[model samples]
Target: MNAGPISATAAATRAAARQLLRIVIVGHVDHGKSTLVGRLFHDTGSLPDGKFEAIRKMCERRGMPFEWAFLMDAMQAERDQGITIDTAQIWFKTEKRDYTIIDAPGHKEFLKNMITGAAQSDAAVLVIDATEGVQEQSRRHGYLLHLLGVRQIAVAVNKMDAVGYREDVFTKIEAEYRDYLASIGVTPTFVVPVSAREGDNIATRSQAMEWYDGPTVVGALDSFQLPATSVDRPLRFPIQDVYKFDDRRILAGRIESGRLHVGDELMFSPSNNTARVKSIEVWPEPSDSDARPNTVGAGQCIGITLDDQLFVERGEMASHTTNPPVETEVFRAKLFWLGRKPLEKGKIYKMKIGTGEAQVTVQEIEHVLDTTDLSSSTTSKVERNQVGEVVLRSRRMLALDEHTRNGRTGRFVLIDGYDIAGGGIISMEGYADQRQLVTQRAKNITRVQHGVPTDERERQNGHKGGVLWFTGLSGAGKSTLATKLERALFDRGYQTYVLDGDNIRFGLNANLGFSPEERAENIRRVGEVAALFSRAGLLTITAFISPYQSDRERARKAAGEHFHEVYIKADLGTCEERDPKGLYAKARTGEIKDFTGISAPYEAPDTAELIIDTSNLSIDQALEELLGYVEKTFRS
Candidate 1:
């Protein structure tokens, strides 16, 4: 059993190298992520000869005429702007071990970058300037990291040299920051005090701080362990893309499960596609069984080229042979509504889950959460940057996994009109049952129709009949324009029927009114009716103060290209003046509540092909332009 004794430093380095830690360094500008890294290289002798000089020459070429803070920043934007924009991964090693450091930006506008960094990290080393203590962005990053389930955290009290290497100062700052972290359910695992500028305690203990007796920045970082990955849970490799080389087709993916090997049976989910693992191609060489699974798991950058290319696409995920994934029609989610407009219930927005996208509506805002405090609010509407718990009702349910268990299938983003409005993880699941409920509830509703039939309707009319959905405030003259349009179209031999809210309430939609839910249902029913009539090829003109954008979008989906939208745009004051039904008058007097033109909210569409201002467009002119657009729409 006699063996050669290894040196203590060698033993420590081996132990550190074995620990697979994924670290993200996050801090405000000038707080020193790059500087700390720079110091780490210098003190540990990682910097080769002429490397410092190389960076110095680069700085000189850029004409900074001073020491460069962006040498280690790496990114061109980071080098030029002197700020990290997103989380960039860099590998470094000390005599004690290796570290995967993710450098993240601090700018408020770059929250997406921060999200990406936090999402990929196991533990975070938050750099806090000793002079500033904790600021708003610091709090925000901390909160987001906590939400992301980053358990272990390290707080580097940097720039201590500027304050005379004050131990008492750092102690006070640490206590204050810890209390705030506690409020958000996070307790940092380690706090290392160092001056990234002076190189004190970064790689070496500061002789300046005899009062301080704790781990150096290098020791603290070396000690931190990579958070345990969820390999035992389930395999979830999101298919980045499939590749074809000659005759071989490889479904490229990263392993998010128990070790996958050659000839292993695997199944692709959501698509319900399956394929066998011909070989897992990881280069420069595939992982051997002798290596632990932690070395290769979710979030690790490796590609798996399967035996056969099975139509795998980005956003799709692969699972194991036995435990298959479930598909559903609806699911509960915690959404961060980052859209400019408030999230409207029963409005269909495109939801992007992994690679799969579907039309979904906020079925119910169970409760909106206060972003600043993370507390529940009774308010039904959630605005920009507000994170809330929402129950979404989708047109079609996609397969999903609980976010806590799986990151791949669990996360999704919402697209409003053309922009990505929001994104978040799947906090809850089981939407198929809700789909059944929604379908069952719709069965009791009876149908109503306008006189003209399909082929006869379109043949008699020059073009197919469709609803030109016009939405604006009550005074916006939706009905007036609709009536004018009907008269003109009729004169032109187009068999058209104008469906106004006043007339519909008198007949079909009389049961509903201005409450958010009621208004949504009314619009939904009308949108459906209009689509049906248009499909039959008749010119169906419908006008209402359908203030919700989601409702309008749903109407478009229901009608397809046959769906014509007209936003009767007008000023609130002009609309108030033109109030035909005296609805706005009554709302202003507070006699009527939850009114569309008064108390209720309106989400204007980001992209509307036609925008008509009734204040400027006389009934004659508005009708002329609208009919013109509609005439061309069908022809196109």
Candidate 2:
């Protein structure tokens, strides 16, 4: 593409054509969100011409104190407490772009304010405290922005003056925080040093910081080459309202991702819905045919008229014809559980994903991640504001995509009963539970199992095969109790089978080995067979050193509500002394891999009904108590 040398009139027209971009400043409390925004307005002269005088007069009238930040701190309590409680959208202009800057509050308690601001922004200026470095909420805000899919980031390391403007200090903090950002997958475009309160290196270049050399605050702002969404992505129009005025039913919404055009064939994924453009319009008419729809994307308000009445409601999306939308009920999500209570598994919660809302249950918690260090070498229940990957199954399906693939479909908010407590982004499309799909993929291969005549199995023992789970450390005497319990149940007219590790490995589980994942798979297989046994009405007793709580949880879920979970609790010292099989000795000597008793993760279950401590109780005593409970609970 070529253009002739610009005329003065054309250049002036080009300047006038620059659309205002919304930028939001967000960070933890006292981390410079307000001070930075205040400085920007001060530098841009966006405040009244007599700004301090205007503030002074306002304060004088109210008999209150005032500061430069008072220009935007319009709330009485905000001034009184010296903390922002809500997002403030203030308009200002630089030499190049007219801007709307959203100042987001950073207190951990005011995350809603942060979200409100982030929701409206095209880009973000992530503020970090230099002296304190990255705190919990600092990492949290970064993670939230990443979850919200905000791409461009400019990190402002505030309070440089506090640390004596050490370039090394700023450099170190910048590097550390930048590494943190990249872990959650964001690369901040720029890291600028400035003392927001003292105005050093903010609006004006500071000579006091002699070694530091980069764009001054104004320079960075003026030099930013704003990228348009039309050049980057496809058209996306989310229907926000359905309006009918003067017999015209118009679909009104913001062009959230890409440009809209007249006669464009659009498909809405979530509704399994599609539509073709009839007319593209704004309130005022445009002269150019190409600009008739005003050549817009990613922040323009327009009304779309369709060829057919699809009866689309608010929250549905409109995309290009070539790219069909996603329809999904379950997706793998990278979630930050922000509720006061830990994210419990199997409970239903409302998920507001993009424009789609559904009741979603946490199918599984994949891993719990540390926000500060980004370590995920462990898995557990997620606490408040703890980021993790959770697989969710929804009561109702909706259009969806992974966060890496599409920001809109990927983003979701978790609702706890009536409250919106957490939010996250779908990171992966969850696989259909493959066990259920196995036969279909295998040319509809029918499962052919030779039946052991139910009567013969009953003759071999007595009742049905059901799982009797025994959980404890390696040397906890679980096997002894399980052995006795199985014998007791066997004597009581039950078709009983014992699945101890040694017994299992010699036959059905011979192919399995030691590793957390392998052990989990082993437990899973055992649990499955136990269910089959239970279905045949045979009593099954299984004892394994399964260390992971997730594995145990899956075992319980797999085996059904009737499955018995017997926790054989024994102290390490007591178990070591009794080491019947000498397995704990081998494990301690490093002869075993992922040894539960020596080197592995353990998640103790909270609701295990029967806990028999063999350290205090002998094998007979534990078995007596367990069998007694089982008989009392299940025997008719």
Candidate 3:
């Protein structure tokens, strides 16, 4: 019996799927990249019928040489210009694996398009013209490939025919390029010499290069390894959209890392919301033989309905509670700037990563790097196409991981107006803390006390000592109430001290500014001083517009159980009217930066022990009420 004729579609479907590898070809312009890709497709028998003949006929009509590059120059503009202006991806297959070849443009003006191509690739073939040796864009593309985290690379010293296929020419260019790649930590799998135009040593070994012995281009590609699956790592599913189809609200997105199973509880970060997976929904339902239909691994896109209708948006990432990503606003990152304009401090840009977008500012430029030689220079601005280390501060907190730990959540791109201005990887997470340094330094120092015990001092003072931390708007009467209470306690023959905001800034916190990190440090120092006074058996009263809740929590931890948060209640309108020093007017006109209650944020205490509405009450009445409570709590 004879088999019937099979259609092209049927043959393709019947063929078993091979291990997939996405490969990108990059180098300087006119380096025969397209010719190499065309040759690979033709020699591997991956081209369809009449495709090669069509390109050859077109070349003849145009009175041009029969070159394989014409096969890839499918676009009319590219065929006429003889240069790839955009990225072109074509799928081909070898016996061992299926490959997606991404031909990235080498022109300097089209580097952004090249980045888009390289970012999706698992490996790369960096082609260099043997006659040209090494060019400017060759080094740059190499650097970018390393930055994109494409570790598997193979160097193709192309256009070997132009150099007369000399063994020394191949050896010289190979040695120089290899040394440069090593400097940037890229180890090429193989360095092969080939004539892309002549189809020599692409799919099969070439006899023209008798002196050289290495894997052919096809063999080199097969040797490149695929990235390991991240399913064993913690789950990081960034929700793209909430879809409601046929009576179910399904959260839809590709699982970026780790595995997701039915009945597993997940905590969404930055928002800190929890939900349980009800079922893994697929487009085409799986068969009964498919084990665990409610489970999915990394790289799979699926929709899932939760047991609880938890409010989750596109930006919130679903992470396992056991190991969740860090939630922070200020982080240190290493990035390359491709914006036409230089990246300057204080200028805001939009950052987008995974499923989240937020306004971001370059808080500080630590250093600029010379990408060619890996040299560092102290600079305040990152110029066009320059790599730099900077501290990026976002308007809102984001759940992010270190690039080394999870590449999906760690990589981000900066948008300047309409275009993607830059891209980066998170290096470190968290803001600067000089106080932490001081704490680490104090570890070796010994404890010392000069006078009577705290109990004896409190007994003699006729009160139990504690700290009263007054937090509110700048002109909300926190300072006025603290001063009045201090005098009232002193008149009653009790030990008391006031740490006024402006008074302490004049000396102790003189060097600190009003930035978020600086404000935290200022509060940290004041909290320590107030704690020391409390230990000395004196009631310590702190009056400051401590805005952030995190900073206040630090103060509470420092002052122990005796610490009391007193929120002096007053709206922004009332506080601005009572601005005695005319600071509100100055802040409104942009004369003062990071001014709480005017420009910056002022987070009111959520669970304050005391709430005093100073707007309605007179100073004397407010003080009398506060005094009564303090005396009752501390009376001996």
- Going through the candidates in the order shown, the clash numbers are 9, 11, 0
lDDT by residue for model 2 (1-636), tens: 112123546544643577557688888888877877777777657675566577789889989765667766778889888888988776667766766678888887888768767866778888888889878888878877886777787888899999998889988988888888888789887788888888887778887787878877666656655655432676667777898866667888877676676777887655555677887668675777467553556657788788888888877778886764455455677776768778877778987865557788787786887766777744547887677778777755466656666565557888886777777777533132222111122355676675776556645654444577888887787777777877888788766777887788888878977754456667778888887777676677788876655567667787786487878898778878977878777878888656665665445556787888878887678878987786776554
Q: Which segments of candidate 1 are over 4 A away from where they belong?
A: 1-20, 58-65, 75-80, 229-233, 238-254, 261-268, 271-316, 335-344, 366-376, 417-419, 429-636
lDDT of 3 by residue, 38-94 (tens): 999898888877788988887889898887887777789998888999988766778
**Candidate 1 residue-wise lDDT, 1-636, digit = tens:** 111123545544553546546688887777887788777766776654566777778878878754435546666777777777766665556765566667787766777677777777778888899988877767766777776677788888898988888889999988977887898789988788888878888888889887878788778887777555566667667676767666667666565554555566777656666677655555455366434222355544456656665677775767775765545555667766768788877677898866567788776676776534557786668877566677775665466777776665677888888988877777543222221212333346776775756666555656766678888887787888888888877787776787788777777878876555567667778888888777777688888888766568778898988787788898888978877778788888899886764565555556777899888878778878887886677532
Q: Candidate 3 has what TM-score? A: 0.69
What residue pairs are clashing in model 1? 315-355, 328-397, 329-397, 330-431, 454-536, 465-537, 465-538, 465-539, 466-540
Which ten residues in a row are the worst by lDDT in model 2? 430-439
Compared with the true structure, the alpha-carbon lDDT of candidate 3 equals 0.84
Q: TM-score for every candidate vs. truth?
A: 0.57, 0.60, 0.69
Cα-based lDDT for every prediction: 0.71, 0.72, 0.84
CA RMSD of each candidate after superposition:
12.0, 9.5, 13.7
Q: Give the candidate number with the greatest TM-score.
A: 3
**Total clashing pairs in model 1:** 9
Model 3, C-alpha of 446: deviation from truth (Å): 37
